[model samples]
Target: MIKRLSLISASVALGCIVTVAPVLTSIYIADEDAERREQEDLQQFAAKAVMRTELVTYQAFAAISDMEAPPGGLCSATQIAQFARVVFNYRYVRDAGAYGGGQYLCSPLSGDVRAQHLTMPPPDWRSKDGYLLWYRQKNPLSNERQDIQIGRNGNYVSIDPQSYVDLIDPARRPIAAINVETNTILALSPGADADDMLNAWKLAGQVNNEQWHYAVARSASRPLGVVVKSPRSSLVGHWPGLLVMWLSIGVVVGGVLGWIAFRRISRQLSFPATLEWAIARKKLDVVFQPIVRLTSGECVGVEALVRWNLNGRNISPEIFVAVAEQNGLIQQLTDLVLDKTLDELSKLLRSRPSFYVSINVSSEDLRTRRFLDVITARLQGTGIRPAQVRIEATERSFMDADATRQTIAAFRNAGHPVYIDDFGTGYSSLSYLQTFTIDVLKIDKSFIDTIAQDAASSVVAPHIIEMAHELGVEIVAEGVERDVQVEYLVQRDVQYGQGWLFAKPMGVNELVVWLSESSSTLQPIHQ
Candidate 1:
């Protein structure tokens, strides 16, 4: 009896560890990821901050370059006008002029009438170009905040110190730019103090999470540094809840069984690597969302949307597609989506000749002719027309305009209607639009949501519609959920629409049922 009790006790303890351990370990890894992401964000901010500061310095140098003492001298109307123009041209500079007798002889700030006396401190350092830099001194023209003054020959420019890190959002995170040599901060956003800045610099490239998480990133171009700090993320709140649930499961199961469950859970948590494996195994899910013709109130086509369900966690196409692209499995994933769409919808598409299924392709697909060739080959064996299997690409896919244009031309020549999805959301101009000949432009859902709102962006939808009309491309408004939007689009002669208002995305069986429900539209072509 004593031996059995001891064995039972050991088994229970071991079971608790085998199951709960994976959950705890995953949470720990997630916490570490949060900190690492924050550090990366800080690094990006530091680099951009340094670049902005460099831009400010270069602009000042350009404005004051080739500046020599004219016969009219420092206070001449021409010289004053030149300095005034410098102030006007350089967005970061507040004061610009030639220095003489230890005072700004004339500046745009002081007017052309009199010299501005600036009781500035001695220079912190002199550059190789004989330029003296005052790191920080009281702003003589503006508020009490300090300003950085750069002087060369008889010319000088006063720069607003905040311009170095003006792009930093104080509400999001506190960041500071410091002179690496002097360890003096040129400027700091709200929520950070001198102590925080100095301490972060001391622990540069190291992480600390006792009171606050902080990172210090240095500039490669100059002797400057940036510091950013964030509190523990809100994900911390989820730990306790998850711990309780996993612990209960662990205690109920034996050690070996618990470990088996743990292995599966870990695999799900390891989404990126599993995604690669899933693609090879052909475990991806593809659903269809119909695109409806507005005038007839009938479903004319469907957009093939890729989806993934791993242990009840449905991975969106946006994520899995990006994973595939990053891992060089994009063409494979595209093939999978294309083949699956054809496999499921070919019979239906053949029976209804005019109905189309739009297949999405990544920017990577446009880099080569592989995608077009693959689709053309697939359509040859099947009785389906290339026109019935349309091709849809986002604006980014057209980044390599010439290469993508040729691929698009190939697709068009093969009878596939090419569509530019998410228009007006990416880099836009008449150049890219006219450069590529497309059959349709799908205005992004974000613009459609603003159709009747009182916001300034409400006007963007109309402008996009007008632009598409001017370019002679047919318009298809996406995410049309309201009757008001439908009426608005129809009034402008926008031909087609896609979203939940007509029909939500459905499975292959569900879509077949949907088509049967619309009996008039589902009549067999040959019949």
Candidate 2:
């Protein structure tokens, strides 16, 4: 029996090291020196692509904007047509237009092109410059082929007038439309379904709007754009690392199972050095990430992120939390975190009463009656208003719909604010908002990361913000990194933002010093 117990202890110790130790190491001990290096590489690649496309589009528009007009009232229609060709031939704009009052002054890149059963263009057609200016010029009066081929082509394929370009009767209907208000040309996309393209155009700023995917940026005094698309093949490259990570996880699980089987068959003794070290020598620390109000750029709150400080290495939350919960020490850890957080906040709040503090709560805390009693007693004892405390519950915790609803109600009834943290992750059930008393929805960093790119978050993020607003819950964007992300979030009417952009996690003394030094001068990194 003694031998078997020893073996069991060994298995547990090994499991703890593999699972819990990693979490502790990541959160507390991992080398921040090389942190997010891969993510940074990906971000830089994305930023460069976006900037390049933006610059190209800008150049095309600027060329058109800078064209010399003929000495005439409005520059004759032919002159405008020549200018359109010149701009389109610059290998950036898919096509250019200077149409007014339903008359197409220039031939668009693709004339009356059609796709399989549909007359429209593909969403990603302009990635190649080959087809930018391939249309043939036609006499606006009689359907006669003109000498001009609209724009210069590197590989000149003589376009057929009778069968292709000039076949469409200009007098019959307007080919390409233009928005004089925005100076944007509108044409029937050849590769997309005509109905879908029309709907996309009509639904500007809405989901699947092609215009949202392509940006028109100003560069060198040109109001044009270049569309740079990363092939799906390249996006597929991210899968290898993810696959390796998952496979490593599977191997770890198999090792634990094999160890369990071996221990069941033949008992052996091994020292529980890892667990002993973890329980006895482990030090707990907290990192403070600033949460700022978007409009005023004022630091309103700080989230206390727990870190497992190992003697020589920092442990990750991923490993420690699992082990802590499995070993039923989560409550103890929570108690420690709560005390540490409140102790720090007590001083900060004494000075800034309006200042708030947010702390994460485990599902165990919600289910346990003693946890509530403990928190309530502390709140009463400390004289901290419930409104000043923000409880962040993960999406996974809220998956237990009944318990989450009950806990949320209990906290809100006691005047405490409950927020749905990591908003876009796990189960994003709209029913949670309807059933529970949620005060705010914190957008996950993944969504915030893509705000600069705009297309990915332009519709989805706004929908989330709008939905939260409709429910009277404030929206806070987390992990904001750049000025563009901030600008985009503010434009989307997000009320609060938090991330490295505002401030890194600081110790109590450092935080106080920072607040004193820059309380009035705190501004968004851009401003």
Candidate 3:
């Protein structure tokens, strides 16, 4: 038992692991894919931003390139101031002037700023014909510390850093344009510091530190490109909720699997157990096959067939019923069938009081008094009369002749007609007919199949018909599929028939509709 319990527990745990492993794996793959997509999107966004900024930078360059040099290879203060004003008039250009001898010659916002101090560019800035320089200083006009860009010589242009900074949306991660030559950030978005932003970019480049993702797009038309840095957390925010949900599902699946494993390993799992559960849950279904009078072609009765639907799969009655009999669960199964059939046929019985319903019975079902009690109790308050319900027993059911005879006598005393089912196929006892007071003998399909085929083969049904008549028992020809078979049964004066030619077995709801639609067409032979 301990070993069995351990196996059950292991099975449950295995089930959970199998179920959750894939979910976690898929989530991880989804995270990686999302990160990849985010990286691509950032790179694309930076590329587009660089393209737009390049347009404005080129416009600035054009403005400066068009300017003419002053006479004497130098610009006077007035010429410098006028040029500054004109350059500032262009969009994105903050201020412009010529610089020589360690001082600005003129400025539009600050006039004659000869004594003023200015930051020097790096030595590498001298080699480039055009250079972009970044420095922080108090603006002469606003008297506030400002991040500034200086476009030196006619080959370069100076513009407001905010123009490029504003291009980075506030909702997105910080972005900046860096000049690789000078190792300077020319412009940065709000909430970003040059030192911290540079460190982030460097850390992102290290394969060991992957917490941050950096997408860099270099400008083919300019010295600088945009770099976008985003934290990894932002890319996969919903993972926490997803992880919790799948883990919970895994636990649930594990519990269910463990229970199933326990049942199986303990030798307690069986179809009869399943059948009992079905009966308790009211899962048994009933279908009716029409039993028609061959001469009149009118449906006089229906056979109640029990069907089991377990977890969306149909369990054949042959398999489950045999299992039930072996396990001594047939009594419970029969009771469920009777209750379900009575409940379903309640309406039809009310409309057609004369309509009889035949129900199959096992020898085990008749060996006890409880079976008779169940039948009596089920019929007590319903509109069904005991006469309207027929009990069908196969010849195999009569193996214990005394018990079978006693059960048949009890049913007859209770006013329920008893019929021998699958007549030609079973024991074929002439003694059962003489010994038991039987009302009907249903000719099995095998014998009916031989009818009208070969005269010698067809001889059995006629003899059975003649014998049934002699015994004053009505005959039901089962499996009468063709018109010729119907004519043969009618000619032989077989009273009732059931087969696909009339109607296939249908559910209770379908039987109601079938009866309604076929009622007018089914007429007596004399009519």
Best by lDDT: 1
Residue-by-residue lDDT tens digits, candidate 1, 1-527: 99999999888777777667765776787888887666556554554455455556666777778355444665777778878777888777888876655655667676653443654456778776687788775555566767788888878788887777666245467778887877878777766787867877877746555556766666544566777776667455677787676666657654565567668878655766788788888898789998877877778899998888977888777777776787788888889999888899988988998999998888888767898888878888789988898888887678788788888888899888999998755533233775789999999898799898765346557756876898898888999999888888888888899998878889999999887787556432111
lDDT of 2 by residue, 213-322 (tens): 32111222122211111111122234456445534565467467556655743431121234334544435777678888887787888888878766577778876776
Model 3 regions lying over 4 Å from their true place: 1-269, 524-527
The CA lDDT of each predicted structure is 0.75, 0.54, 0.70
Q: Which of the two, 2 or 3, has more lDDT?
A: 3
TM agreement with the true structure for every prediction? 0.51, 0.50, 0.49
Provide C-alpha RMSD values for all models, in order: 11.4, 16.1, 35.4
After superposing candidate 1, which stretches have Cα over 4 Å from the reference? 1-270, 519-527
Clashes of each: 0, 34, 0
Instruction: Show model 2 residue runs off by greater than 4 Å.
Output: 1-282, 454-459, 523-527
Rank by lDDT (best first): 1, 3, 2
Worst 10 residues of 1 by lDDT: 518-527
TM-score of candidate 3 against the unseen true structure: 0.49
